[model samples]
Target: MTIRQRLNKQSICILMLILLMMIVTACKSDSENVEQGINDLEADSEQLNPSEEEEGPFIPEGKVQSPFNGKWIPKEAANKRPIALQINNSLAAYPQSGIAQADILYETLAEGNITRLMAVFHVYDSEKIGPIRSARHYFLDMAANHDAVYMHYGGSPQAYSYIQQTKAPNLDGLSWLDGIVCWRDPERRAIPRMLEHSVYTNQKHLEDGWERRELRKELKENFSSGLEFVKEGEEIIPWGQRADYVTVPFSASYTSSFDFDAETKKYVKYQSGNYHLDEEINEPLMFTNLILQRTKIHLIPGDTEGRREVAVIGSGTGYFISSGRAVAIEWQKSNHGTATEYIEKKSGKPIQLNPGKTYIGILPQNLEVSFQKKAINQ
Candidate 1:
């Protein structure tokens, strides 16, 4: 072959090799770009959908939020029916047991200008619950509103008649389950007070009694307390006046008060001129919500013991105090089978309570409730 032809062939071969190298480099760049694109997509996915641990604490399965207090609890516990005990509030029964654990506490006038408490409990396993007293008819209405099992030592004639009419599931300390589920406290009996104030019950005894009675242990399907709660980390400032301290007078002789603690954002309860405490724990009773409901309460027409009848199945005005603030509210109850609805007067919306215990005072219409921006002692 000629030298020129040989040189041309060598040039062509060199050109082909150079073309192959360029193609390989371009392919390598494309492969790297594809890999980088995939990495970017993965990063975007991670940003959009964080892991469970990154969002918040992991909650175990079979847990649900409690309707009573808006706290997380086991589904089983949340589904169980609440228990309402007619706790004696006589001065002699100071520092009642297991009352601090109550999800809801109710104060109303009993006979002889004395006040009584109906403590409603859920998600609790208290060893001791009372100094249980006799039930008043109105308390049964409240208990039925919560779908709770009622417990009392004995009841007024009106209360017994109402129980029979409603067929409410109740345990009576004066009945067949006296020795089995309730007994007179030896320590209390040793005191000089009447034997009526000595009756007490505990969790274990109540549970056994419930089982024996074959009462429904679970709450009714789709049951709601008609209580709304603020979301976590949400701040709700009421438009009403500040209430650092509140005083509720159920009767001329009986008064209940609360002092707000800014640090804990809860109200420290004071009753009978002292801090109310649960004797079992010796801790002062506190609450996160306070509701003073005004209702028509009057003495039964011909009752010998001065048993009072409370009008609970009606609408009324009230005050709701929480987070060191007070707001006027309206409450309505359609019937005994329904829960009370508390609506803010300003917004005309159902008031949302802070997550914790609540104290309700069913005051008479004529009573004058008062609150101040500062503590009374301060």
Candidate 2:
């Protein structure tokens, strides 16, 4: 062969070898890419749908579940009785302090067609709480049921009589501890806000009063809240009507409402045509559970100021609301010293609450409570 032809042949062979190398490299790279994509898909699937064997949230040692809300709390606070404070809920008492930390709150009718709030705190260390109000006789029964230390600015004649008869441990703002444990807030004492709604107190002050009075801080050995809660990872499918919005009317003048927040799965409170916000944090008051308890309530015969007498120690029909739904429930309080039992009407079992804060509204039987599947304004 000629030398030029031999050189051309050698060049052609080299070009063919180069093409073969490129093809092999491309095939290997495509295979590697496919393998990596499968691995990524598997990882994503594991994250989206966790295995049944996977564990839930980790709880630290020396922690115990709270009887009030079913949340984990420090072990030291497990046996400690909660504190029930009477908070003013009038229009002037807007933006009340430290109520967001309450594990459970109760609302009941007071004089003048207005409602009062009783906040029960199991684990709280806030700097301020209240706009403290006077205690009613029915509130004392609730406090006793929780074995909580009661704090109030003053009391009605019936309330004082009940306290004297039961010998319940309490700290009265009208007593000598007025300046020591409870005090008047300077801001609230200003004009436009009534002086009667200026009382305020903190956790430290309450603790001091409790220690001085030698009140029992720990719960009784056999005491129970009689509240059931769903387990972790469990969903509550209420077998009743949807309740995205709830309206609780105490009287023609005052009505309390709640709107369900889908993202947070909580019901945000509204009163006086505005959101009920906390003074300290300026955050809207929300609750995970709401219980509207219907019972007999009326004014005392021949009594002035329209003071109300609520019958709490008996069985009654009610509704338990949570997770944007509500279910009919029966509430029974056998006696003053025991916690109220709530049973589901459909299953005839104890009503189970979702883990978080709860609000119990003591409503009159004659009043009408309504709920809807969607927000009123939206």
Candidate 3:
């Protein structure tokens, strides 16, 4: 063959080889895309958002802003029977600071007209009972007389997690009487075990301090991105307590059972209240009013500590005077101890009854009253 003919033939063969390679590559790419599409279809529903597929109940968006706006009545006209006391001297004997005042109030209130009272304390880092005991015993003694007692704390979840895993000695004191917990905040706290669906932090962990930031992180890392949380409920089953009744900010749709989708790492809210083996179950959290005065009871909002704030609602469940027409004896704080006491102080005077305007600062000691009666006049 001539040189020009040979060159032309070589170019034709090369062109055919290139065409065959392009066809093979195109087929491989098409197959990959088809398989990917099918996997994507099976991974999630057709909708772009998983939240849209979520069908059950969810946390609310806002806190209870206004409580007891029109609910309160004037003190003078309030049905002032004796204060219902839940805390007493037996439960709170440490400080003796408010004991005198508590005795005076107890003596003054007529029999059958007294309230059952309880006291609470908030101690930071209650690691060991040294200086903290001064505060702890005081409240414990005060709460001795009330219907119930509570102690609150706010701490990093890491510390809590360590306690939970190790089961420290101090933890034994708090694991079961009325416990209330707020989820740890994610910004500052971490809870790894709670990431699963329906798994409850062991009840042995009812210690009061719950960092809010840690809870958010655990939930976000485990759940979807759009999950929004508000104060779900005030009645958190702290690592060790129980309540006679629990109220929620919103009613829960899931009652008890839980199933986890391991592939998606999603917690499926179950409707039954039983925790099944190999299933993660979470307790329904109770939403508490941040301002506290908006609660069912008409009193100031306060934490487990003696530090008081101006609240239009009651902090937790306790004795309250709604409309100032009913004298419901509830728990209050005192200067002496951490438990509830029944003593009320008005410029050193034993308050015969809890008026609608009882200043939490002056409330003598956490006192408990036994029997309470509404004024017959009302």
Best by TM-score: 2
The TM-score of predicted model 3 comes to: 0.21
Point out where model 2 deviates above 4 Å: 1-58, 373-378
Cα lDDT tens digits, model 1, 1-54, are 999999999999999999999999999999999999999999999999998777
TM-score-superior candidate, 1 or 2: 2
The runs of at least 3 residues in candidate 3 whose Cα sits more than 4 Å from the true structure, single-residue gaps closed, are: 1-11, 27-31, 34-38, 41-86, 90-378
lDDT of 3 at 127: 18
lDDT of every model, 2 decimals: 0.87, 0.88, 0.25
TM-score of each model, paired residue for residue: 0.83, 0.84, 0.21
Q: What C-alpha root-mean-square deviation, in Å, does candidate 2 show against the real structure? A: 7.5
**Cα displacement (Å) at residue 326, model 3:** 31
Backbone clash count for every predicted candidate, in the order shown = 0, 0, 101
Q: Which candidate gets the maximum lDDT versus the true structure?
A: 2
- Residue 314, model 3: Cα distance from true site in angstroms: 12
